[model samples]
Target: MSFSSILGYFLGGYFALVISLFMLSSVVPVAGFAARTLSAYISIVICATYGVLASIFLRIVGREQIAQWTTARAFKYVMAITIGITFEVDDPKRHLDTVRPAVFIGNHQSELDVLMLGCIFPKYCSVTAKKALKYVPFLGWFMALSGTIFIDRKNSKDARQAMAGAAKEIQTRKQSVYIFPEGTRSYAKDPGLLPFKKGAFHLAVQAGVPIVPVVAANYSHVLYIKDYIFRSGKIPVKVLDPIPTTGLKPEDVDELTRSTRELMLKEIVALTQKVQNRPIAIPATSGDGVVHASGADATLS
Candidate 1:
């Protein structure tokens, strides 16, 4: 470890401890809605501070060391500790040890999804983020340094080109890429999934890589819905079997997309049921009762 990284770790730990103390103090007198609200604000500031410090440390250490320090060290300790989030990875041996590059698709719940991925994904993985996230201060700077693929989702042509480039990256660099196939967070009251986007499937097929589905259990119970305060709890992430794309053509993308979606939907429903300790019902209609951008018959090509 470099001198800068060691210093960064120490400073990050100190700041996290201070913030955690403050958050704990907020709930000492009375654990009410007001205390939760105050803790939520403190948590946001803590995350921002960590982001800035991590960015500066990355810059000091230079590009070659960013991935190593940020993923393996900084993110794992600082973010997970401050937020009080613990991950329960199902079948880590089978899913996490794959040597070949693959496409990792996960359901999005909140901004925490990014941090969770950073903490748990394989060493050589990068994420596909929206182009606008590039403007988000320290977090944006860190992501750019880490080689995140930013796509302009508003423009179809640009989005397609971005996916093409991402596919090439997977094929040439042999690095796994994380993508939220739902395109956005499913923040609805219900757990119904958003329609799956085809770009990720296209990339997996084009690169002839396996599609690994990951389901992040809902956080509405532990995370305050009104104010976004995160309480200490286990966030279960179930990694499903990898779907192979070998010998698949462009026309097979739709079938591949549909099958993957079904698998994820089933896993998500089962996971949520486990969390709730009962059978959770899935509404027949789509998420938010409206067709998502991908629509009913959207296909990859």
Candidate 2:
């Protein structure tokens, strides 16, 4: 009879459907992929909604810089719980914590990278996105509120201007930024890297910060849109040693980007091989095991 009643019914129905799909994905072998995929989509919507709310509150309180960090943890928690995946980041050197006002680069995968970002993103850091994503409703709103740097990848002029602005932010705010040098998701079924664009490298050089190479093992085998394969498993990520940009000029960005990609490519392939060859858990465990805050790994939250 009332608007609230209708809205309540719709919300109830949507959640009921998501729960049913999750149940089917668990037991129905023939329908697992389809059910899981749909459930994953719903899970993202749920997390994004949570992110929008959380980030908004944080932004209103003038903590907009860590807004993405708040939302990323939600993504890692909600998606890992609902979708059954763990992002295990192995940063032995703890460069992720020590590095500040730096440029971090990682291999790009699919839309599922939210899980990875949640697992590995350090505090006071935000990611760069294509300018197009600045208008995708709730997710876009969350990104914009959380200080995501948007670049128009197709237009060199706009892209450079965005990077220049990013460099300035790094200097003034002492913020760290993440970029995908591949400039796009690989979506490949194996561990590999695409040719890197030099934007991130140039930004690091201009900002006079170190370039930290973070790598996530290829989980295309776990999440293959082409084959509709959505399995619950771990995505291994490692944060490599940061390469300094002191005294580095624009002309040197090319070699820096090239060498960093080569090193990350090697580590990515190695991590993927380890994840692939490892024996599947008997009872199947989901959620990150690599200690987040304490323990030998000491991966920062």
Which numbered prediction scores highest in TM-score against the true structure?
2
* Candidate 1 Cα errors over 4 Å, as ranges: 1-69, 130-141, 150-160, 227-229, 285-301
Give the residue spans of candidate 2 off by over 4 A: 1-3, 22-30, 129-141, 150-162, 278-301
Clashing pairs in 2: none
Give the per-residue lDDT of model 2 (tens digit) for 101-152.
Answer: 7888888888888678888888889987767788998668878888886654
Q: Going through the candidates in order, what is the number of backbone clashes in each? A: 0, 0
Q: What is the TM-score of each candidate against the true structure?
A: 0.72, 0.82
Residue 268: error of model 1 in Å?
1.2
Q: Write the per-residue lDDT of candidate 1 for residues 101-208, one digit (tens) a residue.
A: 888888887666655665567666777666778889867887776667655444454334446666777778777877777777777544667777787887788788
On the 0 to 100 scale, the lDDT of residue 206 in model 2 is 79
